[model samples]
Target: MRIEISVESPQGVRAAAAAGTARVELCAGLSDGGLTPSVGLIEAAAELIEVHVLVRPRPGDFAYARDELDVIVRDIETARKHGATGVVVGALTTEGEVHDACAAFVEAAGDLATTFHRAIDVSADSRRALDRLAELGFTRVLTSGRRRSALAGAPLIRELAGRTAVDVMACGGVRAANAAEVAEVTGVRDLHAAPRRPVGSALTGDVSYAGVGVPAGSDHFETDPVEVEALCGIFRH
Candidate 1:
């Protein structure tokens, strides 16, 4: 019955804090699937609220180049300094294995809890990825059940939870209408959502948002309050 919302803007975080949510995933450039937020915003959000903040490194794809990896590592350090409670990250090997020490990433995460992000989804094999993450000591794994949306992938997600020691968190296309069903189908207690008002993308960054894929028409990529409230209603049901 826990709720988590991803917020890219300070305004969104304030709204999420006002909504009385348990945790908030803080980042920026959500128009591109969540780029690293400024240190100021991170610190400011941390100071004003009690919600746990999970920071994302880049807004790009799950496959990170060496430089991007460095950026991710540096971003994590900044996020931690600014009071992030945890972090979300994922890196895939060519064969789709989790890059090196799943434990090392966990360790790199320091005291904050770590949740390997959707990079696990693009892997060649989900089960092997699950085992590696579990072995590496990740607190949770965010997945869409290996399908585009969580609902479609629920079965695989559920199987994953059953097969691995790591916690499985259902994500993608999670909304009020089917949040509970996805949870039920996936047997996943944790969930992640990026619900934003149907606003148009700003496109100010002049960077490519192609890989992130904005759903139809939406301005922001962070979780939307309207959606969260509705989903909460169902989850409570």
Candidate 2:
């Protein structure tokens, strides 16, 4: 029932730690679903927080090309070098199965704790993917329980947790009101939640979507300490 918070930037990491969050998944540009953080962010967060830092690589999509996977591989190496305690990544094949390429990364990470990211939902078979991750020695997999939202996904999350040795980390749509139910059903020790809204892209691409902002009613992903406290408060009892 420990609360793990994801920080999309260096400031988010500092704020999460100050709020007493248990861990920070250090990444960037979460509006596009997170990317590898800069070395400065990782190092600065490590210095400030007692909580573990889980680094993620890549900006979009789990199914990556060779060059992109190389970026991820290199990021893992760099993250470890700069004090990240763990790394998070996952990949799916063209057929929607766990990509075998990830197995090499499971080896390359070399003892920095690793979790297969939410690509679990994209896999055609969650059962097979979880089993493969355990075999590959991934410490965990972030999932929304194979449903659109964690609330609806709780059943499958619990099922997966009961069936596997690999840690099942529930995320997406997990909020203060729902943490206990998720933990109670899934029997998971770790939880990942981002109680913040998006800011802006550190950099932009040619791709454009009109009327698309941070997806927050507000303008930015400032840390919401109250949200963090409320979710942690739910598990306090």
Candidate 3:
């Protein structure tokens, strides 16, 4: 099985590479479920490991406006220019179906590999969305089978994996503890995870740079190389 880690920074990419991960989905604001990474981050990550830039413009739903689609297309182009190995993207219509505009994203990517992101999980019908993605030239897709976690969505994931031409990558709340079980139950060869741990900030003060409801001196999260190694060990064994 090939393991793909969701990484937000150069350190995360280095950690994943050190642990022998196959690839990384490079992004910013991973706490917001990932957004497009900066050009520098993409270039830096590409040097460390195979990097697939996530082309999300913002947080919230995948249903995007025309401007957002344009931005996504532009981001895809930027990722390519900055040395990204591939891109992860998706879009939905108001009716929760694959948006026709996603074609522009693929067109912008040119020869780069494309992965339809977790937006498929929120589609009205994931199976139909999978078919549409395949038609749109997406070689892979990341999904939790429309459930909160891949383990809970194994039945649907297995069903999708059995018939879909596109590669099904089981994601959402994947960890070393359940990675093997998820793969076994879903019959998927690709798995996406973020083995992150909080590192306490050394700067301690009453002033805080975090968003609302976040505590002062909040710790930042980073992908732990040891955790990545543990997850990789499961597939290796």
Tens-place lDDT digits, model 1, residues 81-140: 778888877788767788874454566679887888778888889999889888788878
Each model's lDDT comes to: 0.73, 0.76, 0.89
On the 0 to 100 scale, the lDDT of residue 106 in model 3 is: 88
User: What is the Cα-based lDDT of residue 156 in candidate 1?
Assistant: 88
What value does the lDDT take at residue 87 in candidate 1? Answer: 80
Cα lDDT tens digits for candidate 3, 35-138: 88899899888888999999999999999999999999999999999998899999999999999988988899999999999999989999999999989888
Model 2: residue 94 alpha-carbon error in angstroms? 0.7
Worst 10 residues of 1 by lDDT: 206-215
> RMSD to the native, candidate 2?
4.5
Q: Find the number of clashing residue pairs for candidate 2.
A: 2
- Which candidate number would show the highest lDDT if scored against the true structure? 3
Candidate ranking under TM-score, highest first, comes to: 3, 2, 1
